[model samples]
Target: MKFADIGLSDELLRAIDESGYNEATPIQAGVIPSVLMMRDIIGIAQTGTGKTASFVLPMIDILAHGRARALMPRSLILAPTRELAAQVAENFEKYGKYHKLSMALLIGGVQMGDQVKALEKGVDVLIATPGRLMDLFERGKILLTGCNLLVIDEADRMLDMGFIPDIENICTKLPATRQTLLFSATMPAPIKRLADKFLSNPKTIEVARPASRNENIEQFLVKTSERGKRDTLRSLIEAEDIKTAIIFCNRKTTVRELAKSLQRYGYKAGEIQGDMDQSSRTAELDRFKAGTINILVASDVAARGLDVKGVSHVFNFDAPWHPDDYVHRIGRTGRAGAQGRAFTLVTPSDDEAIDNIQKLTGYKIPVHGGGAPAVDVAQPDRDEAEAEPRRGRSARGGRGKAAAKAEKAPARPAPVAEARPAKPREDRKPRNDRKPAPRHDDLDGPDDGWNGPMPGFLSVGFDT
Candidate 1:
C-alpha cells in the first residue's frame, strides 16, 4: 500500500515522498501500523528491506508530544554497532525535520562531552550503541526510567557482538509498562529468547523467509587461494561493467590493506573500521552515499541497515565466518527489485564456510574456475626483514661458531694453477653462525582494543 494510505502524518508522508517511495516495503507496511497502534512488535526481515523507517517513522509521531528532560530521554533505540546507531539517528532527523523533536547519538569514539550536553538538553529520541549507552547510564548522564518506547534494532547482531548482557541490563532499567520493538534480519534462538522476555503480546512480522536471498541477485563463488583473493577482487572490479559494489572482508587488517591496495591501484576507495573517529566514519559514509566514493571497504558494521541505492555488485574478499553473514553480505545488492551480482572469493580453507552458506541459503552459489590470473599474494620480504638490526644482539662469539667450524667445509684445495689467479675461498659466515638474539619484549603488547585500519566490508558505486 502507498505510504499516504497509512495513517502517517503529512510531514512524514512528505518526507517519504521526497525519498521517492510511494508503496511501503513489506516489513514497513506490516510493522508501521502495529507500532502506530502502540503495540510491541517483533519484526523479522533481511537487510535492505527498509526496516529502519519501520520504527523511525512511527517513533517520530509517538515522541512528538513528549519533551525530553536533562539526562532523561523519553525513548531509547539501541543498535549493535556505532554506524547503525548513527544511521538510526540520521533517520530521526530526516523524518522529524518538520517536527521539533530533539535527538542524541551515543556511541563510542566520540567526545562524551557533546553527548552529555545533548542528554542534558532533554532528547526526545536517543539512539545509542549498547556499550556507550551503558557508560553514560553508569555516569548518571542518562536516565532510562523515563523512556516509554524502546527499540532494539538488529537484535541478532547484538547477540553476535556479545551485547546481550548489556541489553538485559538496559531492559532492567526501563519501565516495565513501556512499548518495545525488536527487529532482526534473522531470528536465532538467542534473539528469540530476548523477544520473548521483552515484548508483551507483540505482533510478529516476517517480510521474507529467514535467511533467504533475493532471487534477483546472480551469485557466484571464485575458488582461489587466500593470497589470490585480493587480486581476484581487483580483476572483477576492473572487468565487470559495475556501477558500485561492496567488497566484504573478515578482518579489519585485511580491510584496511585491501582498501589501500585498491586505491594504490588507482581506484577511488576508502576504509572504515571500529577504531576510526566518529566524524571520519560519517564522512566516509557520506561520500559513499553521495557517489563521490567508488568503494567503501568496511567490516560487519556496514552489513546491516545500510540504505545506499544503486549497488550493482558485491565482492566477498573473504568468506564470512558466520553463515548468517553470508546472507547479509549478498543482501547488499539486488535491492529494490533491481538485478544485481555477487562474487565470493573462496580458498581451499573456506570449503566449510562455502558449504555452510550453501546450506543456509538452500542454493549452491555457482563456482567459476578461471576468472583472471590471481594477483600474487604478498609475502614478507625475508631479506628486508632480516636486514633490520637483530634486537638485543651482541657481537659475542658463541658456541655456534665453534660448532660451525668443527663441521668441516669442503676443501677446495688447489684450483688448477693454470688460468686466472686461484680465487681464495670467500670467508662470509653461514647464516646460522650468528648468535640468536633475544626477542623484543614490546612485541607482546595486547591487541585488545585494536580496531584494525579497515573495516571488514567495502562498497563501491556505479550508475546503471
Candidate 2:
C-alpha cells in the first residue's frame, strides 16, 4: 500500500515523494499505523528491511504538536552504534523537513558540550547511543521522564554490545506509561526477555522470521584455504563483475589490512572499523556512499543498519563469529528488494561457523568454486575496483601497463657462481691428531729461528 494510506501527514508524504518512495515497505506499512495509534510495538525483521523509516516516518506526525521543554526531549530513539544513531538523525532530517522539529544526536567521540547545549535548548527528538545517552542522563544534562515516544532500534545488536543493562536502566528512568517500540533483526533469548520485561502489551509485527535470509540476495560460499581468501575474493570480483561491494572481515586489523591490500592491487577500497574515531568512520562511510570509493572493507560494526544504495555485491573475507552476524553482513546488499549477490570465503576451520549461520538463517547458501573465474577472460574493475584486478592482470589474461612491465622485465640473471666456490675443503687441514702447539717451557731452550715456539724476543726478556 502507499505511504499515504498509512495516515502519514501530507508534508511527510511530500518528503517521501521527494525521496522517491511511494509505496510503503511491508514493515513500514505494518508498523507505521500501529505506531501512529500510540501502541507499543515489537517489530521483528531482518536488517535492511526499512526499519528506520518505519518508526521515523510516523514519529514526525506524532511529534508535530509537541514543544520540547528544557532538558527533556519529547521523543527518544536509541541505537546500538554511533553510525546507526547518526543515520536515524539523518532520516529525521529527511522526513521531518516540513515540520520544524528540533533534534539532537547523542553519541560518543563527539564533544559533550554541543550535545549538552542542544539538550538545554530542548529538542523534539533525541537520537542516541546507549552509552552516550546514559552518560548525559547521569550528568543531569538530560531527563527522560517527559519523553513519550521511545524507539530501541537494533535491539539484538544492543544486547550483543552489552548495552542491555544500560537499556534497562534507561527504561526504568523513562515514564512507565510511555509508548515504547523495540526493533530487532533476531530475538535471542536475552533480547526476548528484555522485551517481555519492558514492552507493555505491545503490538507485535513480524514481517520476516528473525535471522532469515533475504530471498532477493543470491548467497554462495566459496571454499578456500585461509591464505587463499584474498585471491578467491579477487577471482569472484572478476567473475561476478562486482560494481560496488563491502568486504567484511572478522577483525579490525583484518579490515585495515584487507582494504590496504585491495588498494595495492589497484582497487578503490576504503576501511571502517571500531579502531577509527566516529568522525573518521563516518567520513569513510560518506566516501563509500558518494562513490569516491567503490569497495568498503569493514568489520561487523558496519554490518548492521548501514544503508547504502545500489550495492551489488558483498564479500565475507572471514566467516562471522556470531550466527546472527552473517545475516547482517549480507544484508548490507540486496537492500530495498534489489537483487544482489553475496560470497562467503569459507576455510576448513570455518565449518562450524558456516553451519551455524546456515542453521540460523534456515537456508543453505550455494557453494561457488571460486566462481570458476575464466582463465582466458578478464573483466575490468569499475570505479574503485580500478586499474585491473590482480587476478585479471595475471592469470585472467588482461594486459595492462603493469602486466606489460611484468612481461618486459627480464628474469633474474643466472646467479653468478658463488663468487669464489667453497674453496676446496681439501685445502683445509683436519685437526684430529694435530698436537697442541709446543709450550715455551717444553721447547728447546730458545730456538733461534723465526718458527720457534717463542720467537727469540719472548725468551730473550726472561732468560737471555
By TM-score, how accurate is candidate 1? 0.80
- Among all windows of ten consecutive residues in candidate 2, which has the lowest summed lDDT? 374-383
TM-score for each candidate, following the candidate numbering = 0.80, 0.82
C-alpha lDDT score of every prediction, in listed order = 0.82, 0.87
Evaluated at residue 286, the lDDT of candidate 1 is: 88
How far off is residue 102 in model 1, in Å? Answer: 0.7
Give the top-scoring candidate (lDDT): 2
- Stretches off by above 4 angstroms in model 1 are 369-464
Best prediction by TM-score: 2
How well is each residue in 7-34 modelled by candidate 1, as lDDT tens digits?
9999888888887788998999999999
Tens digit of per-residue lDDT, candidate 2, span 1-464: 99878898999999999999999989999999999999999999988889999999989999999688999999999999888898999999998899999999999997899999999999999999999998888888998889888999999999889999999999998998899999999888998898889989988899998888798999998877654567777777778877789999989988887788888889899999998998899899999999999999999888889999999999998999999989999999999989999988887799899989989889987887545422222222332235346445553576665665666789867767757667788777779766456666544454455355553334455535
